[model samples]
Target: MIGSGIGAPEKYRKVVVEKLGYVTGLQLSLRENLFDAAQNFDDLAKVSSELRLLASCLIKFAKDLRLLSSGPEAGFPYRE
Candidate 1:
């Protein structure tokens, strides 16, 4: 749905790619933080919450990107 809908419009396709890149960068940063937090278990709770938030955001970003990439001829793997 998204691929056909957004692909038909170049602007929407560009926006989706930009958004995906932004979220991917954030996920990388969050992964680095997890590594840093490993040495300071005292703040485990906060670190865990941050990790979860990042993961959720990353998942959403990926799903959206996938949707945007799906061609109208192809069946959608997700619904929004």
Candidate 2:
């Protein structure tokens, strides 16, 4: 059986005292992809837009909170 994956050895070379005990492994390369099928990006675009909106809202809320609790004589000062 042949195996292939991320960790699987793709290509290499080694030597041993042949004609005693040996086995051979070979791999063939075929590059004949004239055109890869088109992939839709609409879903990705929508998710990116959603993330941008959420990030923008969170950033604005954080800025507002910082402004509210900033200077001692400004928005709201913490008494200690």
User: Each candidate's lDDT (Cα)?
Assistant: 0.61, 0.51
Per-residue error for 54 in candidate 1, Å, reads 0.5
Q: How many clashing pairs per prediction, in order?
A: 0, 0
Across 1-80, the per-residue lDDT of candidate 2 in tens digits comes to: 11223343333211221322244444423222212212344645899999999999999999999887787777667588
The model with the greatest lDDT is 1
Give per-residue lDDT, candidate 2, residue 68.
Answer: 72
TM-score of 2: 0.42
Q: What does the lDDT come to for candidate 2?
A: 0.51
